[model samples]
Target: MQGHGYAQPLKRPPDTAVLIFLRVLFVVIGFTCIGFASWAMMLRLAIVTRKSLDWGLFVAVLAADVLSIVLLGSEPGDEIHTAGGYFGISLLLGTLVAATAYYLAADIRHFQRLRDAYRAQQPMAMPYGYAGPASPYTATTVPSSPAAPRSPLGPHTPPPMTHTPPPQPPVPAPPQRPAPARIDQVRAELDELSDYLRKHDGHHEGNYEGGR
Candidate 1:
């Protein structure tokens, strides 16, 4: 007799070390993010100290490659031969490196901006001996004098100065009444006590029950 119902397709078990490798991937990603932040910080330091060895970026890139090995594993798989998994893995890895470089380029630009701002704040020294382009990567020249202002239209007059109006004092707030006057209700009972104290001219009995 034919089967009564269609059999369910068996689910493929996850690859061994799948969870372990994925955990490593997450850890590496976290490490990479921290390393990127550190590199950015170090780049700022390099700009200030005028030194080389951006070890942060170097270490982060190296970690990213090692991380891929965790994903790709050491041995060739059956799928590697049939489905071009090897080529796919290779391409994927190349893209990851390129992406990291592109992302770091922005970080580098930010560091450059910070450096320019710091340089601008400091007094400039004249070219004692001609220092060439700061570095090969630096596309633009750092001017000996501060950058000259450019008018959108050639040679425009400066706009007239405007005074900032004095800040108005905040309006005096009206007195706020207590939300529900339970205290006020009790105040009527205390009115006699207030009158007694006034008559006594601030003299008070030391015979109260509470301890000193």
Candidate 2:
């Protein structure tokens, strides 16, 4: 006989704090530096990992870096700097701070959305009647066979049937009689006799006297 036992729960991988810290360091450096190398690395990381927040951060950082460079370049030769230069420096710092804050807010929002989606996808609890991981001690339920479908009529009643008679063949009509030609022949003979009398009436009377 097979021995009964309980199934062990599956183990999950541990979240590494060091790896996360290194990733954050790299992102911070990329944001601070204005070089193409850092930008390329950050862009690659963002794209490969499908991190929208990273992309947003890269854009914000790039904009701020470019603005700062432009502002610094606009300053006149390295004197103690004028009021305009001081204002420009302040503006550049403000831009950097604003950009960082904007991207950070975006990252937080993105994180929230991801977290919400993950929670939505996770099963809250086992389905109402679903049997979870079965244990040897758990009782197996034998589902009752569904009752056989019942007829609307009584169980012993016979189904009603309609009787239809076979169709009969149609009767044929009687043949019609042909018209007579004898009347036309008699009329023709009478016409010919009248024609002969009209042409030779005197000859006929003379021949009769001679015969008397």
Which candidate comes out best when scored by lDDT? 2
- In candidate 2, where is summed lDDT lowest over 10 consecutive residues? 9-18
Which pairs clash in model 2? none
Q: What ranges in model 1 sit over 4 Å off? A: 1-67, 77-79, 82-84, 87-92, 124-212
lDDT at 204 for candidate 2? Answer: 87
Supply candidate 1's per-residue lDDT for 151: 58
- Predicted candidate 2 versus true structure: per-residue lDDT over 106-150, tens digit per residue: 544545565566666666887788877778687688899989877
Candidate 2 yields a Cα-based lDDT of 0.60
After the best TM-score superposition of candidate 2, give how far the Cα of residue 148 lies from its true spot, in angstroms.
30
Worst 10 residues of 1 by lDDT: 36-45
Clash totals, every prediction: 0, 0
> For residues 93-184, could you state the per-residue lDDT of candidate 1 as single tens digits?
56454544544454445455655666566667768887655666756766698778875556677755678889999999999887667887
